[model samples]
Target chain A: SIIRILEERTEPKRDLEGKKVLVTAGPTQETIDPVRFFTNHSSGKMGYAVAEAAAKRGADVTLVSGPSQLTTPFGVKRIDVTSAQDMLDQVLIVYGEQDIVIKAAAVADYRPVQTFDSKVKKQDGNLSIEMERTTDILLTLGQRKQHQFLVGFAAETNDAVAYGKGKLERKHLDAICVNTVGKTGAGFQSDTNEVIYLNREGKEQHLPSDTKKQIAHRILDEIVEDMEADRK
Target chain B: SIIRILEERTEPKRDLEGKKVLVTAGPTQETIDPVRFFTNHSSGKMGYAVAEAAAKRGADVTLVSGPSQLTTPFGVKRIDVTSAQDMLDQVLIVYGEQDIVIKAAAVADYRPVQTFDSKVKKQDGNLSIEMERTTDILLTLGQRKQHQFLVGFAAETNDAVAYGKGKLERKHLDAICVNTVGKTGAGFQSDTNEVIYLNREGKEQHLPSDTKKQIAHRILDEIVEDMEADRK
Candidate 1:
């Protein structure tokens, strides 16, 4: 009975085996100095969860991660980088000819323009670091997206759905995941997430907060379904 | 000079110092048995990141978390939970009289109808677990939302903009964040996330991929702005 059930559940509805999937994870470090740097609260849990889920679904996966304590999931190729620029470089290099690309890394939007060879000493009261915008990886991929799926994230505290929708249009993304911060257990380095799935046809599916692995499966299922519908 | 520059950059906008903010994070475990359980890939990073950011902004925060290894940020009241129903119960107790409610926790859409107290051994060839729908936290909150700002997330893989806008209208959310999961390095456990903000008025803003902290700050700033605008 168990084998039958497993077979039924694990049976591939779509031929995802051998499909190339790429992912990016962890927080990008914007260097202020060699010792002191700017990063975020991302621990690479969500990205790793998705990578694991994809691998379980029998897809070939390449995970590009920033520095974090998370271990690489089994059967997935892993790449490590530090800054957003580094992430962008690695993504471009690996993203070629992939059927799917998941940009789950929390890349820094701005980085210190100049890197000091030595650590900047903490002087008196406070410190100010001149910052400049990093490359827009999603937009770049969107511009170059040929036959692959393009997705982005909109993490907001206010007007989340409205902002997410705007990003979907502006970046030409097939879908987007929106989350709110400044609360308790929803964002950054936690082990679960609650999100709503918004599709191009205006269908909104509200997924209750669940583990990243389950969410990843649901997300991939949706993607596969959407791709099929697109073909149809 | 650094302190001066830092001060110039840190212009005080809206103070949430004494405000009570409630948040939910992580996925609920629908137990199949004591040892075997069903869950998702939620790392609770987004919610936790938001909580840390809020605490940094001097807000008195209450974080309701599912199973996660994340350490509570300094100056935050944390509550641990497991199932969606448990999260809902905790949220109800804390949500009332709060200044803002960010439903960032990804509650499971379904739970096992009956959970086995002991681990179900693999005696048969297959096993099945019955599931039932969990509570709709956002919809319920939207219905009961009084003066508090209510925000939701829309994670869509297709028709992202349309679905996000629909959620904004249907759920009476103050705002929503939309993100796509199919892209590389954008959603879930990645350290960097790119998102879009959408308001009740349908106005949208695009935030390219960045650290969750910066995105959290921007989201909170927008929330304050929206609050002020609503008051007017």
Candidate 2:
């Protein structure tokens, strides 16, 4: 009865009752020492929003989140994670079974190759962390996608469209949301975000700045539309 | 009248009127491309909380914040910044005049040596951002401090006390707030924090987990005590 009430309120036309969705949010830390790590300013707000929106639309949602203070969305399965490797482990487990996948995590590009078990002693001179390339989770997911509608986020400070499109093509993603970070009232640490969506068919739709929750719903709407068209 | 009301609310015994305080908060961005940059997940809560507390206590507070969505604290003059160089310029401008200086911004240790004017093209293989050391803002401030009570933040995940003390000594800081980040509700995105304080005399004090606002007031209290101690 409770499930029926939730499903009914979601509206049958936009219902995703049978769909399985997987989403990733936040920043994956790259440990330098037992007490120190390299991480980016990803608040995980957008990813959680997307996950919440999908779950509300009746999709069975699995959220793989990095360390954040956000409470889990209702009716969504959550997997807490820390490092990039930790994220990969959790995501790969449920990725193959999902009908849709969205990766919004700002994964660290490089990590300290030498992870000190103890504290890294401060030297007299400039200290450097020798970094090595981390596994490209999106790229890997891109390669494995068959029936899934895969989405990725590209955070740029300049040329948002060009970079977003490039990532869309290179990663074999169904769609990509591109936004410039560090602008006033936009990106990382902000409640609102402005993003441009680029699809595999070379179509671009610019979504005006809005709360991350609103944007999340908009993105999900597009995915629903695309999935419906494909079925025909 | 409003000034008087604010003044009356802030207990006269704790008043820092006529005192000049400077605080740095948020994460400094390091440019990689015109559209991309490297940054850390520093929410600037602790720094902002400190600035807010000092301002409420009648201090003429100047908050130099990196890119963040936080609202400016009342009675505090806010200076927005983006990169490490940007932070340094602002801090240096008023360093000589400040009675207290708190370096809470998570400044990027290194920046891409070569910054692409446009979007950096994604290649078939791994992409590497060659990084070079940025200015050590804290170390420079420590060297330059004469009458100012300089404070710094050391975010560690392990050996917090030892590493924090080491940083305090090497940087010649008047005091340092050392905390282990990457733990649940501890650092970066959390509203609460647990920290250990180390002063120039090698004295150590531990602060239990509490709201950033409470912790901020505690930090200000310690700075006030030490400044008063130094006056005699």
> Which candidate should be chosen as best, given DockQ against the real structure?
2
Q: Which ten residues in a row have the lowest lDDT in candidate 2 chain A?
A: A120-129
| Per-residue C-alpha lDDT of model 1 across residues B158-229, encoded as one tens digit per residue | 676787888888788889887665432236666666678888976688878887767777777877788888
Interface quality of candidate 1 as DockQ? 0.01
Clashes counted in candidate 1 amount to 98
Q: How much is B39 displaced in model 2, in angstroms?
A: 4.2
Taking the candidates one at a time, how many backbone clashes does each contain?
98, 4
Local distance difference test scores for all models: 0.73, 0.82
Q: In TM-score terms, which candidate is top?
A: 2
Candidate 2 stretches greater than 4 Å from native: A1-12, A34-49, A66-75, A104-109, A118-130, A151-222, A225-232, B1-12, B34-43, B67-72, B122-129, B153-173, B176-219
Compared with the true structure, what per-residue lDDT tens digits does model 2 show for residues A1-232?
9965784676534377889999999878777554446666678999999999889888999999997778899999999998888998899999889999999987777666787655444434444445677788999999988899999999876677897898898889999998887643236768898888888877688889998987998888888877787789
Docking class of 2: incorrect
Q: Any runs in candidate 1 off by more than 4 Å, and if so which?
A: A1-232, B1-14, B183-186
